[model samples]
Target: MEETSSATMKAAVGKDYGEIRDMVEVVDDQPRPGTPREGYLVVKVLACALAPGDNRVLSGRTKMVQGPPAFPYVIGGDVCGVVHEVGENVEGFKPGDCVVARFFTAGPRGGLAEYYEVKATLTEHKPKTLTPVEAASLASSGTSAYIAVENTIKEGQSVLVLGGGGGVGTMLVQLAKRKKPSFLAVTTAAPKVVQDLGVADHVINYEQENWWEVAEITDQAPFDVIIDLGQGVSAWKVARKYNLLKSRGQFLTFVGDHHVLWAQGIFQIFQSMGPPLWRSAWTPCIPGVPTFRWQLDGLPDKREPLTNLFKLVDEGGLRVVLSNGSPFPFTTDGVQSAMEQLATRKAHGKVVVKVAEE
Candidate 1:
């Protein structure tokens, strides 16, 4: 081993919020791995997904970027990569394991790098049906939907997915059907895709502006279960329309922080009429049954939530849309166009960036 044993890595680095191309600089020799060198494992990052969050994190609109250990950060969350090196004392996973993960706290310095370190638990084996980029897209949206359906729902209940054409909505609409919900509906901006999935018994397009008039989801009045993984006010309005009291309904959304989630949970305690349930849901960092290939945070195989989901995908319960085209490459020059395209959300599915040839 060379004395210092420092290795070079490529990352999309930035100091300020701007277009991905304008701010990203590919510098050489930025050192391979950092401390916790004991538990840490370095992955040769392959493909990552682009979402609206990337724009927010990069532009500082989301206020998600934390202090220090910040800036010059790579802005990506959904990722899939092959194991290049493993820290000593780390067991279960070996070099070359391909894992999927969400680099939540780490940011660009996190998933977007050509190589990055991850705790073993966040990664899982890619579903056989998915490519790297498609698998990467599953972390936040796929798993959140999985958790929502499994945890909060019951069979023969009426369900609605607000902002239905989104990644989460796409998965939720399908997975919720697995429970044989009585009524399943999804709302989206795209009318055609809603028609194509056929998972939703009813589909409403928000683009029409008159969308709400026909969106009266129930003739009997209000849905039994509501999953709102979209905007906040929109969620509150829909909840008021369809939610029933004393019926034990489940509402899922991205609303609420640590405090808000607990507070909303309390309202469910006192109200006889269903007082709104503010869903503050997160994708599991752990793997579930059927065993995924990649493990981060801990042994990859040890995580149950992710592995369980894989089994579902394998069994045809969970579905991830694999978009056409090669993943956008992970180079400094190409990223500008990728980020610009990401902003448009014109692409039918999650945009992928291929970091390294696998």
Candidate 2:
């Protein structure tokens, strides 16, 4: 195992909760991760991908749910890097092996640093066909997309992805296409980008037209599956109002109308959880209505999903979509710019920060 010579490392850190630009800064003196504990590996991070959730943690928007931010909180979760040290009980990984991992730590520390400690269970060998940045994009978003597609998509089913341009959404579109859906449609502002993928049968520009009102989309109404990635609409209400789902159809959401949660304070957010739970549990009782579900939790085991996702990638069935000006340098300004782009919710694809040279 190669050992880091220094006891400290440079990291993009959130000193306190407020704004990404204000709170995120690079520091050279942050303590470097030491030896891994059992079932863990200490990784020398090469690149990290930014997600909307990182903004929530840094901005104190989800403080009530996630607790207060730890001072000098690192600001990334999806990481791709080389394994530096493997702890006891860890197998199939060794020092110098390139890997990708998702760190689900409290306060969300680890990814942005020069070194991070991650569980072996959540880590996987990076596909040779993908760069570190591309591999980094998969750990979280790909896992979510894989699980959603596995659970909801089936051959000959009709699928619609609301907001299909972000990190998770783009991957979802690709994964859903592999399922050989009878019809695949996506609502996205980046119509050109999504259309270029050639996976979706219809790309409705939500910015230019109301997706539900569009004849092409509505004509394909009563979809078998609708996956919402927070496109500023009440997916459940829309599904019910427009009769968008077939009987026993499934409605899955990573986040439903997050603007309400962001605009309203902590109490409102906590209060909002109730209705989803109620609906997810009881909505099926009604005839002809789709089942409501919230996909907020991470999969308990990611190995199989990641293995399948990587195999698909190796076959050229999937690829990471990088936003403009991505592969941002590992600096304060670079990370701030990346996070700022992510906060806008307008990035065509994944925003990534290159932490070190591969």
Candidate 3:
């Protein structure tokens, strides 16, 4: 990696876990771009997005499945940028290549700065059609949704996506749409957006009425797959009570309960395979049900899944839906507003923060 003269870079620092305003501040003390170590590269971030997971960590609500982040952290994991520096041992990537990266598991402080350092394995070449902001918005959320669809959803199956207005939800809906499902439904506050965007065949306004009570939704029970992005207890209970899922159906959730995280973390402090072990061991025993959480720990490399996502985008088969009037400027105020909109749970598709000009 070549040297840059600048000694500091601007970053959004989380002083302590709390409110958005209290937690995040734009500061100039962040270290300048670093020389890449072996198998790593430094990126000049053009865009970074705010995911719900980012706020969960900022508010001290994250369950610490792997480990907790230190105080005064930098927040954000999704990044779309140009390779500014390449490590000695890296291959297939060089300086000036446009790439996308997901660093949620890397550490607490990540892409929400002028420059970010990440391993080569976690980065992917960006598709030509996607701008930096669009690519940033797709990183972690897109990868997870794509993998879930590939693993669980099948063509001609009926599908349900809870919380379909957010980042991962939007991607899940689009991926499922591509499969030509017999029936496709999504729970979102903004039904018009889903309809206008043609992302789902059925749109249930979760705010207007309970999902189970909606005749349009109840009529389509026993769906072959239900991807629960909302993680609402009531909705989960309703699905079980109404037999909304088929016998061989799959119910997958990435946002498991915080209590589960607490248990996982506490037990891990003593034994390595503790709560997560129990979860994996016991979840499959329930009679006549197929349920599983998105497994981040010990997961295989995401190259295949991410490559498929890029192909979808390049082929014009996938569309990224942004929240209404977004692509928020990269400023303290812009980031704060983005987090607040996500907290409202009414955002239409993903919310992205434009970090810098491409």
Candidate 4:
């Protein structure tokens, strides 16, 4: 082994909470990007996205997780960056690879700072189809929607997507169509936009109408799949309305009590029902999807996830919509703006805090 020096960088910390602005600070002494092995890779962070989840955490939604945590709790998730170094034994990726990955939840700090580690399995080849920012947004948000819609849905079945204009909701629409579901219904703040996605056969505005009624779901027929991206009361209303197992229907949702959602640990209690159904009975998550070594090489190239997702996008099954404005992106100083956007409950797509490439 040879000796190497670690580098320092700037980062924003989640020091306690009254508000994000008061809490986040640019801290020094951060680790420089470095590789752990010849095959291991490190990324010099280009950007990290701030979403409602990040905002909620900053604004004392700590009950959703392990704690109020601590001061200087760095906040940010999802990233796209250039490869800083590759360990001696590393195979394909080189020092200059421009890659994108969902690196936040799996590690300590995320794409917020200038650097972080990259797992080969989860990393994609960054198609000429997307930019770093777009890739960062897609890696996590897009992937979640893809999994929820594609993995859970069957071909030619009608589906309902609640909270349908947000980030994951948009992806859900795109991926759902790729499955070639026969009919699509959506409940969102923006009715026209969801319809424009081409996957939605019907779009109901959450503000002016009852999504269930407009979808004609309750009286007409039940949906085969329901994707919920929002949480609490409203989500329950939709879940209870149409979850029919005999019809082989299921509900897939990402928003819930994070404190209870530990690695899908809650599934053990539901064992009597059989392997946990994500949102709907029809859509079963891939078993043994997460493993100790899965991240090291990025999401598997040979695995069906990437290839399936790409095919969907190529077929116009997946799309990325941008919020190109202030208050659209979540940030520290922009806490009030972030909160206002989420609180108004008006956004139709993913709201992100843009960190770089202004």
Candidate 5:
């Protein structure tokens, strides 16, 4: 790895975990990342996408699981940038190469900085068709969607995506569409935007009516797969109560009742895993219970899925959906606003912050 002249750089710094507006501020004195360690690259960040996990860390909601962040922590995960330096044992990437990556193991010390050190395994060449903001938006959410759709949806099956207007949800809808489901539906507040994608057979405005009661959706009850991006187990309970899943269908969720788990302390975290494990073990024996699953964002290898995502983009089969007023300026107020918007959990799509020009 090569050395850079600057010893410090500007970054969105979180002084402590509490509130987005109260905790985060832009500072110029943060130490610039030095040489990339082995199998890592130092990225000159162009943009960073904000996610609910960033807010969770900033607000201390994930403290129990993640532990307290180091003070003046830089919180971001999804990053698009030019490689500034490459470490020994790394290949296929070099300085000045545009890339997108997720700092899945970096925790709070992540890509909100001017320069971020990322594992080469988590990085991919940025698709030519995507802008810095779009590329930044792809890593975390895109990979999650890719994993979910690849593992769950099958051809000729009926599918329903909860929170289909969200970052991961949008990607799931697009990827699932290619599977050619017999019936496809989504529940979202931004029905117009999702409907315009021309994938879903029915778009249920979850705000306007109960999705389960909507005639179009009810008629398609017993969905072959239910992918929940945000509703968590609440949606699962509803699906079970209403018999909305096929006997052998799958219910996949990316979010969990972590607040409850966190409140119960570390011991209960292990204890709480019991129900999901027990359900997984017994669901096949039960008559109507769909296989219940909890999906986490961490992936063993992100490179292949990211490459596939870029291919989808290049092929015009996928796109990054940004929320309104996104690509927020990279500043104290800008990052604060972005985090707040993500906290609402109502942003129609991904929220991104522009850190530098391409």
Candidate 6:
């Protein structure tokens, strides 16, 4: 085991904020996982999932990486790997244990590298039935989707998820399906793919039919809840135009509540620093409609949220959709290719990068 101290590992590192290829480079001299500080453990990564937020970070679009960051930083959020070492303060885990983690803190974001460090509090043992790829896909997107649904949705209500074919949308579909809403619909170019998930009762093909023009979506509108997992502000336009949300219906967007502010980096950075209280300062231009985004700090307990999701998987109640029906190999090219797919938002489900053979 001492030999681990002398090992060098391959890692996809971000040298600057720009295009994926230009900003990211694969390097082999990266140091291997070493002994962790208290409350943390080292895991030899097996798989890591590509997140859209990562693309934003890579493109220098987000403030999450605000302040001067050291060069050659690695950015990844979700991973599943084998424990290689543990700190004295860490409990309930030991070397060789399979675990899943979501590490959102700064500094060489541990996920894209062959060896990663995760806080014990944010880690959970992988469920017995899931493959490492499946486990890796759940941390960031899964938790975001779960937090969105858990906080806003109520039983027997009508719900609509835009961009239902993407990673977070896919997880939102599965989690929402378990709630058994009165009526469920999703907007996607590939209606058949969403239908195959058995999560949506009505699949509206946004490519072929205007959301307001489609009877399947409109009839079910004035919904009790609308989860906007889509990319742009078009969904908000549709929601306001069609009076799609009930007076008290909750509208949740992963793109942030005041997404337009995102275009204004200064204001976005200000709001990003706080709890988005700025939203309350101005009323929605469209009265009687409520819209909000998931707050990073307000999310439910990390370990339990994922543990419950994994329980759903173990019970055969949930499924994770991977891009192209397979995991991308753990290599520089593979990581870049996966990031590019996520940037297009065309991926059917979460894009997972296989880091090592399990």
Leading candidate by lDDT: 2
Candidate 2, residues 194-244, lDDT tens digits: the string is: 988889999998889888888877889889999998753477788879899
lDDT of 5 at 354: 91
Candidate 4 lands at a TM-score of 0.74
**TM-score of predicted model 3?**
0.88
Position 105, candidate 1: lDDT: 60
Order the numbered candidates by lDDT, best leading: 2, 5, 6, 3, 1, 4
Better-scoring candidate (lDDT), 1 or 5: 5
- Give the C-alpha miss distance for residue 189 in model 6, angstroms: 1.9
Report clash pairs, candidate 5.
Answer: none
What ranges in model 3 sit over 4 Å off?
1-5, 63-69, 104-108, 257-283, 290-300
For candidate 6, write residues 1-358 as lDDT tens digits.
1122357778888888789877777777777767898988999888888777677666665644432176677667689999989998888999999999987463226588788888887888997888999889888778777877888788889998887988878889878887889999898977877998988888888888887678887777789888877644566667767889887676676665433323226666676434434443343444675654444423444577887777777888787888883487666777788888877778888888887886
Root-mean-square deviation of Cα positions for candidate 4 versus the true structure, in angstroms? 7.3
Better of 1 and 6 by TM-score: 6
Model 6's alpha-carbon lDDT is 0.75
Question: Stretches of candidate 6 above 4 Å error?
Answer: 1-7, 63-68, 106-108, 257-277, 280-288, 291-301
Which is the better candidate, 2 or 6, if ranked by TM-score?
Answer: 2
Query: Candidate 4 — which residues are off by over 4 angstroms?
Result: 1-6, 27-29, 37-39, 59-71, 104-108, 215-220, 231-246, 257-317, 326-347, 352-358
lDDT (C-alpha) at residue 18 in model 4: 61
Query: Model 2 lDDT vs. the true structure?
Result: 0.84
Best by TM-score: 2
In order of appearance, the predictions have TM-scores of: 0.76, 0.95, 0.88, 0.74, 0.94, 0.89
Instruction: Write candidate 4's Cα lDDT for 169-247 as tens digits.
Output: 7777877776777677777877777777777777777778866655365644566666666643355444554442224
Instruction: Supply the TM-score for candidate 6.
Output: 0.89
